[model samples]
Target: MNTYYYYDDKFLLTLYAYLKQTESSIVRGLSDKWEPASIYLEKHSLTHKLIDTLNSNKINPNEKFDNIFYKAYLRVKGKQFITSNEADNIYILLKAINEAIYYKKPQIYILGFLRKEIIKTSNKIRTRISCKKRKLLADNVEHYNQHYNGKFYTIEQIVNGL
Candidate 1:
C-alpha cells in the first residue's frame, strides 16, 4: 500500500515551531492567516495573478482552517469530510493545500516538523474506529473526498500523491 503524507495539526505545530525558532515573521504571518503566502509568491514570481485572483474571487485565505486541512487530509488518505456547502467557499485553503501537495520534497521540508502531530492524529482516528466501522469510514471518506467535496482533483491521484 502506498502511504500518503499531508499536512495536519502536527504539521501546523511544526511549522509554528520552526517559524518561532527562526524568527521568520513572514512564515509566522502566513501561519496566523494574518498575511497570505500569495504575497510572497507574488513578489518572487512577479506574477500578480494569484493576488488578482484572490481580490476578484474574494478568497479568504484565512477560513476555517481545521475544516480546510481536514478536507485536504481526508482527500489524500482517500477519505472525505467536507460538505458541499463548506467546499464551495474555501478557495484559499484549497489553493494552499494543492500547492503543498503538488510540490513535495524540499518544499514539504517546510512542513516536516508537523509529522509527529499528523501521525498521531492519523493513528488516533484509525484506532478509534473498529474494523467494520473503519472500513465504512474509510469508504465514506473516499466518497466525500471524491464526489460531495469538490476540493479533491482525482481520488486515485491524490491517494497516489500521498
Candidate 2:
C-alpha cells in the first residue's frame, strides 16, 4: 500500500511547486489565466472557439476525480506541505485527469491546460523526488468507473461544485 508506487519524480517535483505556490484549492491550481475554467463555465463549452469546437456535455468527467482533488485539497488546507500519501493521491488525481481526458469525446484541451498548471506552478520547485511509476489508470472508462464508482460530473457541472 505504498503510494510511492503511483507517482513519478517529475510529478512530485511539480506537486512540490504546487504546494509552495498556491494558497488555495487544487481546482485553482489546475486553472489558467490564459485558459480559465470560468470562461468555459460561462460559455458552457470545453474547447476554445479558436480550436476545434466541442461542448461540455460530451466531456463527462468521473466523480472519482472529485475524490482525488478532495484528498489533495485536505493535504494543503493550511500548511504548504505534503505527506507521501498526500503526494500519491495528488498524483493519482493527475493520472485520472489524463484518463478522463482520454475517455471523453473529441479530446479535452482544458485538462491539458490543467496539467500544464502543475509544471508551471512548480517553476520554483527545483527539488526532486524520484520513484518508479508502477501503475496507470484503469484500461477503460467503464471499467475504471465501475471500480472507482466516482460521482458523475461533466466538465461544466464540475466547475461550480468542486
Candidate 3:
C-alpha cells in the first residue's frame, strides 16, 4: 500500500535542518522521497498558501505566527489523520526522521525521544483547539470509554455509542 506523508511547518523546518547537516545514505534516501511530496504540497495546499501569505506580510504582522501556523497545521493534520489508515507509513517516516536527528546528535538518549517529541508537538498544536471544542472532545472520549468498558473506539463506534 502507498503511504502518504504529512509535513507540518515544524517538521519541514526540522527536515530542512537535517538535510543540511546529514550525509547519511538513509537520510539522503528519505530526503529524495520527500522532495516530490514537498513540491506537491507547496503547489497545492491551502495551508502552504496561508504560510506564504503570512511570510509575505500579507497577513497582519502583529498577529502571532504560531497561532496561525498551528491552526493551519491542525486542519491539515486532522484531515489527514481522519482519512488515512496507513499508520505504518507514518511510523516509518517518523522513524527515519527521528533516526536522522539521533544520528546528528548522538549524545541525546534515543529511546522514546521521538514518541515524546510527537506528544509534545501534538499537545502544542492541540492547544489551538478552543476550550469548548476540547471539552466536547474530552466528553466524547469519556463517553466512548465508558460505553466500551475502556476499550478503544473508532469514530464509527463512537457515533454508534452516542
34-124: candidate 1 lDDT, tens digit per residue: 2244333323331133224324323433233346676565665543222233233233433443344334332434444333333333343
**Residue 60 lDDT in model 3?**
32
Model 1 lDDT-worst window of ten:
137-146
Reference-based TM-score, model 1:
0.22
Q: What digit string (tens of lDDT, one per residue) describes model 2 on residues 7-86?
A: 22333333342232221222442443323433333333222331111112124332333466654653444222333554
What tens-digit string does per-residue lDDT give for candidate 3 at 1-162? 532233333333322222222212223324344344333323322333323432344223323334656546756645311112333333343454444343433322332343344444334333333333322332233210123454332223332333
Q: Could you arrange the candidates by TM-score from highest to lowest?
A: 3, 2, 1
The Cα local distance difference test for each model comes to 0.32, 0.32, 0.34
Q: Worst 10-residue stretch by lDDT in candidate 3?
A: 16-25
- Worst window of 10 by summed lDDT in candidate 2: 134-143
Error of 2 at 35 (Å): 20
TM of each candidate vs. truth: 0.22, 0.22, 0.25
For TM-score, the strongest prediction is: 3
